[model samples]
Target: MSLQFHNQLTHRVDTFTPQIEGKVSLYTCGPTVYNYLHVGNWTAYIYWDTLIRVLQANGLRVERVMNITDVGHLVSDADEGEDKLEKGARREGKTAWDIASFYTDDFIKGMARLHLLTPQHIIKATSYITEQLELVRTLQKKGFTYQIDDGIYFDTSKFPSYGHFAGLDLDAQKAGARVEFNPQKKNPVDFALWKFTPQGETRDMEWETPIDLLEPIVADGLEYEQANKKMGFPGWHLECSAMAMTLLGKTLDIHTGGIDHIPVHHTNEIAQSEAATGVTFAHYWLHNNHLKVNGTKISKSLGNGYTLNGLGEKGYSPLDFRLFVLQRHYRSEGNFTFENLESAKNRLHNWRNSAALRHQTHDRLRDDDEKSTDDESVSLYASSQALIEAISNDLDTPAACAIIDEAFRKIDGINLEDIHQHALTSFIETVDNLLGLALFDTSKDISDDIKRLIIERERAREKKDWQAADRLRDQIEKSGVTVRDTAHGSIWEYVA
Candidate 1:
């Protein structure tokens, strides 16, 4: 089957076709780098990473760009709070640039620990300031931008389809607007493209607001204090559009982010970008749902925003957490609890043991035996193909995982010598490539000394020396290898 995804733009599961055949241009909304990312913040990244893997598995060359919002992203989506980086600086007693640098490094390290594929171009929003200004200029030239006291704002009224993508009720938003709303805005749903620094206060991150963008301002909102070069910065929505179009082109094959971005952030991206280029900003938009903690929304006030380090502190590796994330579909809201995580950890442990079987069976299947395939041989080969197909159908990770579980169940029932060595190895490789679980790396062969101990234990068991066999089993486990004495034979598994 061809690749498919629930395209949020179309609001349906659509077949994925790239703008250019065999080449996919993907843009994923990256972290704001204000602090260490919590599990809730990381779900989108992991989901998008899976999308990249699935695309490559389908034989498509994916050129992906992810944005690091080192600047312009505000504490509030309403564009009324401090820049997240600046706030992080104040909280950590560092400069905004220093905060961005530190958190960006932490984010990258976390991605590595989770085995996420690095995007081809991970651009920082600060690096594309000039490009962002050019986009604002384009919007201004097209008569799609207006200036207020705060900054340059997109004229949502001019773009009649502004709320169409998000299905936003502009009339309701305007009618229910609070009295404290910014009356200077032309429309209640209008968003900032650039934000000016408040008067009498300097900021750690600010840029010059071009004079041309300041002209044609509102009658009551025109005030320039810096010799026609007011200090400002790009809006949170502006950076993604600028960086995405500048790197990926005017249109993208796929754009992905959390579901929360639909109403404000992504809708504005569509508005400002399409108004500038007169074309669809992205062909497909994919959104992953939120992750909650113990059935509550992840919140710092609730102290449920668990970071990767937090999970590591509790003795769960990043891969274990990755398996936890993939246990449910990406579009499904996941509930995070230690109990749930323990289940994923155990599942991963079982898969690692199954992965170890390949090391035992390698180089043992005869050529003649390969010609006469057994049920186990066909099962392993078919399981690998089924995994790809399941993931291709809108990234059905849970289904793909179930397929592996079924194949491993069969492998568990049969004799180790009867296993198909070549098919088993290919199946493990497929699991690693598609899931990024690094099963092979974790399931290495035991040392020669440990192998000898296992042999001694087997000999003791054959002679019915129960005491001696128990002693040898203890010795084998000391080396982090535990032997499972099955009816077929003993299988070695990693202890932790």
Candidate 2:
């Protein structure tokens, strides 16, 4: 089956055809690195990881680029307020550069813990100031930019398809007196491309632009005077367009982010990029729905936000959280709760145990007999194909997980002696590859103390001493090994 993605630009689930055959050029918006990433932020990365895995599963090479917004991203998406990094520095009592580095390291660690594939190119917004300035210059030269007292602004009226990607009704939005318009802005929807540093205020992240003066060109009743070598910073929307085109060519095969970005951030990107290049900014725009908690958006302001460390403190492995994310469809909103996470934890525990049992059974069979059959290979291939088909249809991870569940049921229902061990192993490994669950690495050697506790727990269970068994189980868990009692015996594994 051909892969399909629901492109936000076209508002349809279109078949994916790469700009270049057998390869994909993908870009995903990275975090602002102002603070610890909450689970809501991580959801976008999880879905993007699944997309990359699915693409690679279909034998396509993916060159993915993700950016770290260390500078220029403001507290308000509307191009007003302090830079987020500077705000974070004030809150934490550190330099803006230090804050960016520290939080970026934390973000990377979180992604690694979640088993997310790191992008091939991880660029920082601060590292590409030259490119950003050049992009602003290009827009200025094209007569698409105008100057105001605050900064260089992109004239939305000049871009005919300004709001096409977001399906924004520009006329109605302009007519409605919903938002306070900037007096210097010609159109209500005009956005900043460059922001001039406040007079007599020194900023840690501001830079001197090459442009000698902000031209005194007047357009739409807005006038400005030239200031030689004005110190300013790039706008939030300009960073992505500059960096993406610098690394991934003028057009990208896929550009993904949270659905929240569709309205402002991504809309501006499309406007500035297409206006400059006169071509499509990206071939496909993929967005994942937000992650919510308790029927509300997961946010720090709500006090419902959680970091990976916070989840770890609650005794949940990162992969358990990853499983929780995968059990739901990316396009659908997922309500996060500890109860749901516990359910996913148990499910993953059971799945890992089943895979471990299969591995043990396969080992025993291999020792006894080395014979294989062509029918077994055919069956394994068919099972793999079914799994791929499930994921390929717009990344239906829930359906793919259901297929794995069915496979496990089939393995359990059939006779162990009659089962082809190699095929079963191959099928399980392939599923793990696609899902990135790390189920096959279940042979983690338990410490001798944990082994002794497991023995005591087993004895307590044999004696029908429920209280003692429960106590030993608690002790085992405190030692960082999860204990699962099986019909055969008690099983233990490290807590990730």
Candidate 3:
């Protein structure tokens, strides 16, 4: 089946067609890197990682870029507040550069724990100031930019289709803003492309604003402070366009972020980039819906923004949260609770147990006279193909998960002697490849000593010697393996 995705730009599910056949250029909005990411923030990353996996599974070579916003992201997500990195520095009593480095390292560690695929390029916004400034200069030359007292701004009035992507009503926005809007801005929707540092204050992450990019009025007027060496920074929306174009090209196959970006951040990116390049910024746009905690919005004041470390303290691994996120469709809003997370944890535990069956499948089949069993035996090969089909259809991860559950249920019903070891191992590989749950890494055969103890325990149970059976079970538990005596036989699992 062909790939399909619900394109936010078109407001419909469109079949995917890369600009170049068999090659995809993708961009994902990354973390701001001022603090540890909450589970809500990690949801987008996991989903996009699955997108990369599915693209590869469909024989497409993906050249992806993810940015780390170390500078210029404001507290308000607009141009009106303090930069997040500088705010983080004040909170932690460290330099803005140091705060970015520390949190960026933490984000990478979290990605490893979650088993996410790394992008081909992980560029930091601070590293590309010159490129960002060049983009602003291009806009300035194209007459799409104007200067106000605070910064250089993009004129939404110049872009006729500025609000088309989000279906925004500019006239209504202007009417709503009559009471408390920036008096200097020409339109209510005009956004900053670059912001100048206030005259009396210095920023930890400022760069010299190019004199040529500044307006003649601002550069020549004596009222402007520090005009010869003005320090400023790129707007939050500017870096993504600049970095994506610099690495990928003028156009991209896919661009992904949270739904909140559509109205402001992404809309502004489209206006500025297409205005500068005279082409569509991205062919397809994918936005994941927000993740709520306990049916409430995740807020700092609520203290409900649980980080990976916080979940670890509660004995939930990153993979458990990953599975929880995948259970819901990406376009649907997800409500997260500890209770819901526990269910996903148990589900992963069961999957690992099923994966452990591969090791025992060979042993059980070796004793049978025929190497293969009945014609009705389960075919994981067909299941693997079905799994890809579900994912290819707009990243239907929930459906794909249901398919896995059904396949595992079939394996559970059949006798162990009938399970094909090679097919089962291949299925496990597909699961790890598509879902990144790391089943193969987590599930393994028990030590031979533990296996012998299980044999003795089985013998004792066959003879109805309950005390000896109990003793052997205790010995097996000491080695961190638990035994479940089903009617079929004894099954061993790790105690994690």
- Local distance difference test values of all predictions, in order: 0.90, 0.84, 0.91
Give the clashing pairs for model 2: none
Q: Could you give candidate 2's per-residue lDDT for residues 306-413 as a string of tens digits?
A: 888989999998998998999999999999999999999988876775565443344334344335434444566678789888888989999988887776665553
- Number of colliding residue pairs in model 2: 0
What range of 10 consecutive residues in model 3 has the weakest lDDT sum?
Answer: 369-378
| Model 3 Cα RMSD, 1 decimal | 2.2
lDDT of 2: 0.84
**lDDT per residue as tens, model 1, 212-306:** 77764334455645446679999999999999999999999999999999999999999999999999999999999999999999888999999
Q: Which stretches of candidate 3 lie over 4 Å from their true place?
A: 217-228, 363-378
Clashes of each: 0, 0, 0
TM-score for every candidate vs. truth? 0.96, 0.87, 0.96
User: In candidate 3, what are the lDDT values of residues 1-496, reduced to their tens digit?
Assistant: 6999999989999999999999999999999999989999999999999999999999999999999999999998877788999999999999999999999999999999999999999999999999999999999889999888789999999999999999999999988996655789989889999999988789999998887887654556565545556679999999999999999999999999999999999999999999999999999999999999999999999999999999999999999999999999999999999999999999999899889988877634445544455332346888889999999999999998998888788877456777778778888899899999999999978888999999999999999999999999999999988888876888787776
User: Root-mean-square deviation of each candidate, in angstroms?
Assistant: 2.5, 5.1, 2.2
Off by over 4 Å in 2: 178-181, 216-227, 363-381, 413-415, 443-496
